[model samples]
Structure formats: C-alpha cells, structure tokens
Target: MLSDLPIRKIIHVDMDAFYASVAQLDNPELKGKAIAVGGCETRGVISAASYEARKFGVKSAMSGNLAIKLCPELIFVKTNFERYKEISKRIRKIFLDYTDLVEPLSLDEAYLDVTKNKKGNPSASLIAQEIRERIFNEVGLTASAGISINKFIAKVASDYNKPNGQKTVNPEEVLSFLEHLDIRKFYGVGKVTAEKMYQKGIFTGLDLKSKSLDFLETHFGKSGRYYYHVVRGIHTSEVKPNRIRKSLAAERTFSENLSSEVFMLEKLNHIAEEVSKRLSKSKVAGKTITLKIKYSDFSLQTRSKTLPYYINDKDLIFKTAQDLLYQEQLNNSVRLLGISLSNLNTETKKTPEKESVSVQLKFGF
Candidate 1:
C-alpha cells in the first residue's frame, strides 16, 4: 500500500546554529565559547545561541537577562543580517547546482526536491551529503540535512541529527519512523497543542494513529486531519521554488515606553519609510495596513485597515498607521510599534497540480 503512493526525493538542509556559528567563524576568540547572536545584558532577546550556550540552557527568543542567569559567561554578538544574507546566497548557489526546485525557509535553511536533479544522481542521501559538504567547504559553515520522500518527513528528520550530521528516511522506513516519533517532535505541533494531545492520551505517533479521524477532528479541529495523514506517511506538499512574499513590515522596540500617541508619529513615520523601502525592493504593494503595538507589560494589540487599492508609498503608509494609532485610545504605555502591509499584489494564481506517479522503494544510498 505504501509503494502505491507517489514519492519524491526531498532534502531539508539547515545550517547549524547559523547566526552564532557565523559569529564564531568571523571572530576566532568566540570559537567554542558560549555566545549569542543578538540581545544584551539588560534589554532585548537572544536571536540565536551557540552549542556552548545551549549546554547552559541559553536559547533563542530567551530574554537576555534570563540567558545571562543561565550562562553567566555568555558572549552577546550583534546581528549582521547583511553578512548572513551574503553567506546564504553562496549556500543557495550550491543548492541550485543540484536542483532548481529549492524552497528557502529562511537564510539558514531550505527545502530542495532532488528527484530529478541536475547531478543525475538517484541517491537523495548522497545529494544531501554533497550539499552539506559544499556548504561547509565553500561558505565556512556546517550544516545538517534530512532526506525523505516528502517535505514533512524531511523537515522532521533534519533535526534528528545536529551541528554537522545527516539523516535519511527511506520510503520503506517512513511508517516505522513516524510511529515512534514523540508527539512534541511533530513539526507543526507546539507546546500548547502537544499538551492538549497529551491530555487526550496521544503521546506518540502510534497513539495519534489510534484515534479515529472523527475523534481527532472533534478534538483538534482543522489540525486533526493534518495529524491524521502525516503519521501515515501521507504528506503531499510540493516544494515550491518561488515562494511569494506575503507581507512587508518594519518595527521598533523603544528603549523607553511612550504614554501618548503624539510622541509616536515620528517613530511611525520612520517605520513606514523602512516598510516602503522594503516593499519597493520586493517590487510589491499591498492593500492592507496593520499597526502593531506592544505595551510595556508585553501585552500586544493590532489595528488594521484594508484600503480600496494597493499602496507602497511611505506617506500613505504612515497616514494609514497614524489613523490606526488614533482609532483607539491608549490601552497602556507602548514599548514597541510596527507597520505592516499585506494582501499583496504579488499573490499568484493557483497552478494546476501535477499528476502523481507511483514510485518504487529503491534508495540508491
């Protein structure tokens, strides 16, 4: 029955502690030391942590103060987005040598469909290894990879190994592998969802499989159907090469919270200008404008207005954001403000699905 399903060779390549590793690579003094890519001792959040930092419970999205409490020796480095983008371009060049069917998830990772690669290699495992090696040798960075019959499995498998390793889940091993997988390891399942699943006695993929479709749907809503299929080795998401940009945004976290909307106009104008620059760079415009406000207490609020037509001008964006700012009274002192444009003009027409073909379980590696 598994052999009857369509199969595609997919590889998910993830750079190992990308931001932190890049810092180490550029500065010899940071090598093998506990380091974070962003944040500071008093304010902000850690963007990425090194393996050394991870050993001490330091992690991304953690408050800098908390991270310091976890690892007192943690070294915080400034983020260099331009440098990261430069390295990412080099890595992407290597991927293109293997296949044009590359879908980049971020500057640090991407999904590549190598079923019919330019290398003429039937072994997806070998392709993944070569890609990782190339990334290390050419970009001065280590990467990990997961190779499987589908994107979902490939993404999950990629994390099984870390720093500089690879894992391949052959078509035949998909069921056994997923069955034993921890419920929390499912890519889309977050802490909240996992806890909910645990309450329902679904701790592993096998347990999840035991629940009837109706039972799962009754409990999990739309996600229930997704969980039902993935465990059975049945994910059909294609690797889309040119993923569209959904939104453009710019935001700032103030060092001091402002109590009045009058003081936010300058900040809003600057943010709008930044958003406009990004929109122009992406060559896209949007109909929806959103204002995001984060209070001093960390509470968040959003106000949105969908225009009659798309816009990308700074003045227009600032005016919309200005209108939104006064639309509601101040809930609390605002610490952060952002402007985003969505419902983009770049939205693509849906393409017809390609015909699925039967694939035999013959992994060359």
Candidate 2:
C-alpha cells in the first residue's frame, strides 16, 4: 500500500558565514578578506568567520586567541549582538512574506515549507533564488539555498553549494542521493554514532537500509527507526508552530536608574545571547526587539523595533538593543536594563510574492 505521506516543497536557506558576511558588507575594507566578529581580546570567542578565515582553520566557538593564531592577520571585532538580532528579524520577515511555515535552524539557517504557498509561481527553486537576491539587495548580505521534497533533504542540500549558490534535490533523485551517502553525513549520526554504525557494518546508507527494523531499534533506541527511514529517503516530520515560549527575561533593579555605555553594552549582549540560544533551540525566529531601561528615580522607558526580517545572530541582536540603548539619553544614572524579543514565528517554506501567505509544495518527478 502507498503511504499517505505526500511529497512536499521544502527549501533550506542559510546565510553564507552570516556574522562575518554582515561585517564585510558594512565595511568595504574587509571585503574579500578574512574577518572574525567577537572581541579581539584574549578571552573572547570567534562569533563568526568569513570563508577566507575559515580557509585558515578559524571557526565559530573557537577561542579568539586560537583563531588569531591560526591566521595572524585575521581581523577580530567586538560582537554587535543587538545589531545582529535586528538584522535577523528583517531577514526573517522576508521569509514570512512567502510562507508562515519557516523553521529556523539557527540565526543563519532555516527550512521553509512552500507546499501550500501564496505565490502563483510553482517553482520553489526560483523562489529560493528570489529570496536570496532580495536578501542581498536589502540586507547587504549573501546566502545559499537548497530546495528538496522534505526538510531532511532540503537542509542537507543547502550545504552542497556554499557562498551564494542554490541547489535542489527532487523526489526522484532522493533515493539515489541516499544510496551513495556516507553514514557520517546522516543527520544525527555524529562521530560516535557513526563509529557505532561502523561496528555494525553500516558504513553507508545502503548498509543502514539493510538492517532490520527490530535490530536497529533494539540497538539504537528510537533513533534507529529514524535512521531506517532516512536510509530510504523518508521523513514524516511537519513544520509545526506554537511550540512553546522559549524564554522569559528579568531586569536587574539597580541602586539608581543608570546611564552607562559600558553597563548597557554588557547587559544587552548577555540578554541577547540568552534569548538567541533559546530561540535557536526552539527552531524559531522573532521579528520584534524590545529594550527596557529605567531612569535614576524609577522612570521607565521602553523601546522596540519591528524589523522587516527575522534573525538570530547575537551581534545583530545586541546592536539593535544598543541602538535602543542610546536612542534616548537617561535623565538619571544607575539602575535597570532589560532586553527581550517577542512576536515569535517559525519561518518555514516560502514562495516569492508581496502578500503571499502560505506555500503549496509539490514534488515533481
């Protein structure tokens, strides 16, 4: 009997070295050169690195000192987390323009479902290109995209081409793609799991497919069943929204309402990082950035910006808060700072149209 699961139109969009790319976009001097965002100081980590820096073995989460060691000339800068968040919001808003079914994988990557789309155009590949172009034109950054029949295939395909390229894996080609794939490349099969699979003679998708369901389940737990289907180019997960509140923030009450540049930057970055991690985990994106500050004697002021895009980058996020931080001068100094992001929406599949709401994804082949 044929399964009830219908094919889908899924596109995975990933910005090319998002943080570093944004920095490069803003500074012509950094163009085509290796750049890293985060503090240039010893304790800071590399927030993002350009392809050029990546070529030299620099990567995000690597220590700032080690990154500079890898590339003596690598440029290190403080992270503008607020700025990143604002820009991320703007970028995501673009996705919502196409479809409400966007599942953000990270600040720089997301899966869009265009299965039932608003755009009259039926080609997801074209839509991906249009989104990429729109991002470049509006945000001054470049992104790569991948289109496929499901999120599993689309996310993997997005990485096939990097730095402003787009690729698509149609349904007919999925089985073939899985057949030749290395076991290590299978989603959720990391080094340890791959080694375990190797011990079980599962070096490729073919080997995995050969394993009986009971045997796989017995050995690998619930994940084994997942792997079994993946080996066959099948996945049943849908783009679900309204998951849960990822985060709630608290503001510090200080001795006095404060106006301090160093204090505000410190507070905003911490909050943005906290919010970003939660959003990343929930696979969600937000379009609103809110800032809260209280004056010396207890006068409170709140500011927010609804970006035209969605984002999760800490630097961008922090910068936006920083902008809010300075937009109004504190009449009194010393007490309370808060940052929050609400109006959350998961960006999924999208098609190109100004007022398009949802995408209708259909597999061809």
Candidate 3:
C-alpha cells in the first residue's frame, strides 16, 4: 500500500566553542592562541575553551588549575555575556528570516523547522548552508548546521563536522544512515544507558534494530519504545518555537573562597539581583528558588525552596536564597555560589501572525 508520507525539513545549528570563539573574534591577538574563558587561572572554573586549548584536554567546567596543568600556555579570559547575548540576538533574527519555527536550545544553538519557509525555498540543505555562511560573514562567528528529515538526525549530523560545516541527510537516506551510527551517538543515550545497552549486546543501531519491540520493552522500560522507533529512523519531536522558559539563573565564581556566612549572604544577594534582572527582562516569574554552592574541594550542593506563587522581585529573590543558604550548615569554604529560579511562567498570547505560520510536525520516516 502506497500511502502519502509526510516529509519534513529540519535544521539544527550549533555554534562551535561559542564563548571561546566570541572571545577570540573580539580580540585580534587571541586568535590562534590557547584561551579559556571564565575566571582567573588560580580559582574558579573554565566556562569555555578555545579550539587550541581543547587540543590539550581543556574543556568547559574544568577547574582552572587542571586546565592550566593540561595546557600550560592557556590564557584565561573573563566571560563577556552581554556581548555574547547581543550576537545571539542577531543570529536569531537570521533564523526568523527563513522560518518562525525557531527553537533556541541555548544562546548559541537552535533548531529550525523550515518545511514551509518564508523564503519560498524547498531545499533545506541550501538553506542550512546559506544560514551558516550568513552567520560567519554577518556575525563574525562560525556555525555548523545539519539538515535532515527530523530534529534527532539533524542535531547528530551537526556534530559530524566540527568548527564550520554542514551536513544534510535526505529522507530516503535516513534509515541507512542511522543503522551505521554507534549506539552511544543516539540522542538521549548517555554514558550509563550506553553501558547498559552494551551489556545487553546492543553496540550499534544495527544491533538495536535486531531486537524485537517486545524484547526491548521488557528490558529498557518506557525508553524501550523510544529506542525502537528512533533506531528505525522515527522521531516526532518538533521544533517548538513557543516553548516556555522553564528557568532563569545567574551565578558567579568568586576569586576567593568564602568561609563566613556574611560573605555567602552578600554573594547570594548579588546573584539574586542578577536572577531578578533576568526574570524582569523576560517578564517572567518563577515559584522555585535554588541555591547552588560549590566547595573549594570541587564538591557541589544545591538547596531549593518552592514558593506558593511566582516572584520576580529582587528582595524576595535574595530573601528566599538567603533563607536557603542559612538553613544549611557550612561544611567547607565555598568557591562558587549561584541563584536560580525555576517553575517559570513564560506563557504568551499568540499573535495572529504567529498563529498563521505555526508548524505541524510529522512522525516516522
């Protein structure tokens, strides 16, 4: 039986080493140099590592001391989030130029559904290439893009070529391509899941496909069906442009470890203020307030309290975070403190223009 198949054109764009790349682009001398963006070389963590520093195993969230040990010549640069956000805004505008179905995963990555685009173009691959070129020329930053039948394939394909590149997987080729891929490379398969899959004798997509749906379900639980469909090139997840922000957070790593409650309270106040500013900027309020603390020895802990109602006030933010902080007994000197608000209210009334162009995603191949 020949049934009409719903074909989609999805594109996933990921900026390569975004923070480090921006740092290098803004500073001429930083080009071709090993640089890590974040705090001082003596304290805190690396937020991003340039390609040069990455060669020596320096990565984001690694301790400054270890990063320096890995790459002795690594230069640490302070993160300029304001500048990065501005560049991200410009990049987002470019995506909106093609389709309104743009789902930003982060400041540097997004998924775009261009099945029926504003450009009146049917070629998703060409659009991906054009977007990458425009980002490099207009934003002075390199972007990698992947075009495929669905979001899962596109996101995986984007990482196939690092730095600056694009890959397109046509609908007809989706099944064959997935079969050759490693099991670990599947979208939601993490280290623990991959290890479990390996123990089950499922080492690759081909291996996974060999098992019966019932067998997979019997072993892997609810996720079993997810693997069954995905291995057969089936995923229905859409690029949700109207997805609400679940959380707003801001945190800082101090140059010196704080031991006293006074110092912690002051830092929490600053962090709470930053979170409030972000919430206000987004015009969103959240009910849950979380306080994250990283000790000098690299251990991390978090304390959270959910309120009865949403709040965006700085005073309330500080007070909530302060209360959480004081409730916990000091076990060690804290190297970093952070404040975040989750359970956010990001609902927005849809405009007629948005309603007219909203995408309807299709499932399966």
Candidate 4:
C-alpha cells in the first residue's frame, strides 16, 4: 500500500547553531567554549547557543539573564547579521549547483528538491552528503541534513543526527520511522498541541495513525486532515523556489523603558528607517503598517493601518507609525517598539503540478 504512494526526494539542510557557530569560526579563541550569540547579561534574549552552552541548558530565545543563571561562564557575543548573510549566500551558491528547486526557510536552513537535479545525481543521500561537506570545507561551518521521500519526513529526520551529521529515511523506512516517532516530535505539533494530543491518548505516530480521520478532524479541526495524510507518508507540498515575503519589520528593545511618547519618537523613526530599508531591498511596497508595543509588564499591543495604496518610503512609514503611536494613550511604560509593513505588493509564484512518480526503495545513509 505504501509503495502505491508518490515519492519525491527532498533534503532539509540546517546549519548547526549558525549564529553561534559563525562567532566561533571567526574567533578561534571562542571555539569549544560555552558561548551565545546575541543578547547581554541584563536586557535581551539569546539568539543562539553553542553545544557547550547547551550542556548548561542555554538556548536560543532564552532570556539572557536566565541563560547566565544556567551557565554563569557563558560568553555573550553580539549578532552580526551581515556576516551570517554573507556566509549563507555562499552556502546557497553551492545549493544552486544542484537544483533550482531550493526553498530557503531562513538564512541557516533550506529545503532542496533534488529529484531531478542539475548534477543528475540519482542518490539524494549522496547529494546531501556532498552538500554538507561543501558547506563545512568551503564555508567553515557545519550543517546537518535529513533526506527522505517528502519534506515533512526529511525535516524530522534531519534532527535525528545533528551538528555535522545527516540522516536518510529510505522509502521503505518512512512508515516504521514515523510510527516509532514521539508525538511531540511531529513537525507541526507544538507544546499546546502535544498536550492536546496526549489528552487524546495519541502518544506516538502509531497512536496517531490508529485514530480515524473523523476523530482527528473532530478534535484537531482543519489540522486533523493533515495529520491523517502525513502519518501514512503522504505530503505533497512542493519545495517552492520563490517563497513570498509576507512582511518586513524592524524592532528595538530598549535597555531602559521609556515613560513618554516624546522619547519614543526618535526610536520609532530609527525603526521606521530600518523597515523602509528592508522594504527597499526586497523591492516591495506594503499597504498595511503595524505598530508593535511591548510594555514593561510584558503586555503587548498592536495598532495597524491599511492604506488604499502601497508605500515603502521611510517618511511615510514613520508618519503611519507616528499616527498609531499617538492614536492611543500610553498603556504603560514601553520596553520595546516596532514597525512592520504587510499586505505586500509582491505576488506569489505558483509552481506547476508535476506527475507523481511511484515510490522506489532507494539507497540509505
């Protein structure tokens, strides 16, 4: 029955602790040390943590203060997005040699559909290996890859062997592999969803597979059908080359909370400039402008204005943001301020449907 399903070779490549790794790569003195990229001891969040720091429970998105508590010796490094983008481009150049059907999820990870690749390589596993090798030798960073029949499984398998490792789930292995997977490990299942799944007695893929579509849909709503198909190894989503940019935003977290709108004007201007620059670089305009405000008490508020026409000019963005800022009275002392432009003018590219190929057992690594 599984053999009747269509199969496409997909590879998910993820750079290992990309930001932290780049910091270590550039400064050999930081190698093998517990380090985190981004954030400070007092006022921000860690962007990425090295393996050494992970041993101490330090991780990305963690409060810098909390990370310090976890590992007092953790060295904090500032983020250099420009440097990361430079290296990411080099890695992407390598990917272009294999297939144009590459979908970049971020600067550090991407999904590559190499079923009909430029290199004419039949073994996706070999392509993944070669790609990882090139990234390390040429870019001075380690990457992990997951190769499988579809993007979903490939993404999951990539984490199986990480930080300079690769895992391949052959066509024949997809079922058993997913069947044994923990419910928490499913790609879309977050903490809340996992807890909900646990409540439904779905502890593993096998348990998920045992539930009927009606049961899943009844409980999980629209997501139930997705779970029904994916567990049987049926994910047809293609790797899109041109992923649309839904929004462009820039934000700043202040070291000290500001009590008045008078002080925020300058900060909001700077953020608007940044957002405008990003919009210009992306060569897109937006009709919607959103103002994000985070209060000292951790409360959040957003104000949005959608214009009839798209605009990306800094002055226009700033004016819109300024309008939103004064549109309401100060909720509380503000700790963070942001501006984002959405409802972009950029059009989404549609990928033409291709004929499905019968599943074939392939070489595994």
- Per-residue lDDT over 283-333 for candidate 4, one digit per residue giving the tens place of the 0 to 100 score: 999999999999887788999999999999999999999999999898899
Q: Which ten residues in a row have the lowest lDDT in candidate 2?
A: 353-362
Model 3, residue 264: C-alpha shift (Å): 1.1
* Predicted candidate 3 versus true structure: per-residue lDDT over 1-365, tens digit per residue: 00133457889999999999999899989999999999557787888999999999999889898999989999999889899999999999999999989999999999998888899887888888899999999989999988887788999889888879988877667788888999988989998999999999999899999999998899988999999988877776777887777788998888888999998888888888889998988999999999999888888899999999989999999999889988869779998899999888764444233332223343221
Per-residue lDDT of candidate 2, residues 42-64 (tens digit):
54446789999999999986766
TM-score computed on alpha carbons, candidate 4: 0.93
What C-alpha root-mean-square deviation, in Å, does candidate 2 show against the real structure?
Answer: 11.8
* Candidate 2, residue 38: lDDT: 77
Error of 4 at 323 (Å): 3.5
Runs of candidate 4 with Cα error greater than 4 angstroms are 327-331, 348-365
lDDT of all predictions, in order shown?
Answer: 0.91, 0.77, 0.86, 0.91
Q: For candidate 1, write residues 1-365 as lDDT tens digits.
A: 56777789999999999999999999989999999988888767789999999999999978787999999998999999999999999999999999988999999999998888899998999999988888888889999999999999999999999979999998888999999999999999999999999999999999998999999899999999999999998898888887878888989877678987778999999999999999999889999999999887778899999999999999999999999999989889988899999999988546445445446766664
Task: Give candidate 2's whole-model lDDT.
Answer: 0.77
Candidate 3: residue 307 lDDT (0-100): 97
Q: Which residue pairs overlap in candidate 1's backbone?
A: none
TM-score of model number 1 = 0.95
- Cα deviation of 73, candidate 3, in Å: 1.2
TM-score of each: 0.95, 0.67, 0.88, 0.93
Clashes of each: 0, 63, 0, 0
